[model samples]
Target: MNYLISALIITLIIPIWGLLIYFLNKLLYILLSKISSEKVAMTVVNYLTIPGVIHHELSHAALALLTGAIVTEFKPFWPDKTSGSLGHVNFSTRGSLFTRCLQCTFTSTAPVILGTLSSILLFAYAANNTVPFYILVPMIYLIFSIIIHASMSFADVKIMLKGIWALFIAAYIICLYFQIDFLNVIRLHLIAQL
Candidate 1:
């Protein structure tokens, strides 16, 4: 059915986009490195993606606090070649095992959630041609920048894996609470598109 196809497309969009961005970023770095020093290439890439880095770090910190975790340190932008990290949020997990797992998973995935929402809103805005050309240009750039850095780091993934089971349960509960029908929603979207 159209709805099932739409649902499949929606589910696969994030991972596909993440992989594409990852490879493109790596290729950009390699090309830049060939043309310049590694350090310079890194610096250029960091500067280009600074906005997303800031958003990503802030999302982590925000979710940490929301989930009852204590954020001990927050760095929005600290490019460390040795660590290969643009920024980091150090949070102390609180609550029981379930709660802690939920906290870790939510905090780790905040960037992707927030970035996707942000991109969707920006795209909606850009779709409206009434916006001024100047504003639209920056909005498009910000959407691109946010999406490129929306993926979780390896360390973040490990942290999330610790609590992914809890996350799934919570997600399912939320869907139930909202009476969400993914297939219905997607089918409606498909109808609208047609």
Candidate 2:
């Protein structure tokens, strides 16, 4: 029972945690603009994005190359204060949208998603077929990583409002369907510890 509740809380917090980071970036951007020029804030966004963009695009390029496609050019978008770029990288696709999208999704999310899956599988093996372990450890790690990466690379007010709102609504529905009391459980256990 405790494990189930804990899993629910962790899952729920994942999205909210990502949202908080998104808000924090905007807050910092606003403060930087107040102190100096908007260009400075713009510069900051680009700086933050450089490494992330490189890694993400590298993943895409690697995938395309693996598929034996010609990656003609890769251009990481030059950062500017006028636009938000955590360093944008483009892969010149050499195949159908299906292949490109597959590469894109795998490139963007493989580390976190696959890593979490591995962690879950490990826990499952180690825990000796415990039901609670089936639900808890993997979910906590998976959602936590999702929150981290999503916050860093995905979440933003600049993103589509409909998409963001829709995802949130869907996630809540998922939680509800699983009969999870996420917030209350977290407050009692995890939040207090924090």
Candidate 3:
């Protein structure tokens, strides 16, 4: 029972955080637009989020390769006229439905996972070591940038949510049968080790 609750919380937290960041980013974009031309605002926004954009797209590509999907198109920052994707990865979907769906879900959610890990590690390192002010400020900015940008677009979520139920069921079975609190294990090992 406790493991079930933990699993649910772990599964839900990242998506909620992503949605919050998505809305916040949209609001910031609108606010920026009011101060400048839409084009300028977009450019500025993209520039500010370059690090996140790169991380987001690279994560997709990396996962695609890992899942044996052929990555055909990968744009870290493409100014496409029609698609509103600031960055994207177009990969072949030739796999078992379960594998494809799970990979897609992981690919879409990779930014949050990677960004949070990166931020925590950086913070831990900074705390453990005596860092200079100049280095510390940029590190802080980078961490915040990653956090603010670690959200998937609606389209990305839609693709993942198509098989979300299946993923949930699989998670439940794994946790219930194994009596494993996966989240607690991750929190203890990954976070504590840092």
Top-scoring candidate (lDDT): 1
Model 1 residue runs over 4 Å out of place are 1-24, 31-41, 181-194
- Top TM-score model: 3
Instruction: Give RMSD (Å) of candidate 2 vs. truth.
Output: 11.8
Q: What TM-score would every model get versus the actual structure?
A: 0.77, 0.38, 0.78
lDDT of 1 by residue, 5-63 (tens): 44345434534554566667778889999999888887766777789889889889999
lDDT of each: 0.78, 0.49, 0.75
> lDDT for model 2, on a 0 to 1 scale?
0.49
Error of model 2, residue 56, in angstroms: 5.9
Cα distance off (Å), candidate 2, residue 75: 5.9
Please report, as a residue range, the 10-residue window in candidate 1 with the lowest summed lDDT: 2-11
User: lDDT per residue, candidate 3, 76-186, as tens digits?
Assistant: 877566876677888776688887776777666767677778778989999999999999998887776776677877876886686565566667777788887766677
Candidate scoring better on lDDT of 1 and 3: 1
* Clash pairs (backbone) in predicted model 3: none
Model 1 TM-score, 2 decimals: 0.77
Q: After aligning candidate 1 to the native by TM-score, how far in Å is the CA of 91 from where it should be?
A: 0.6
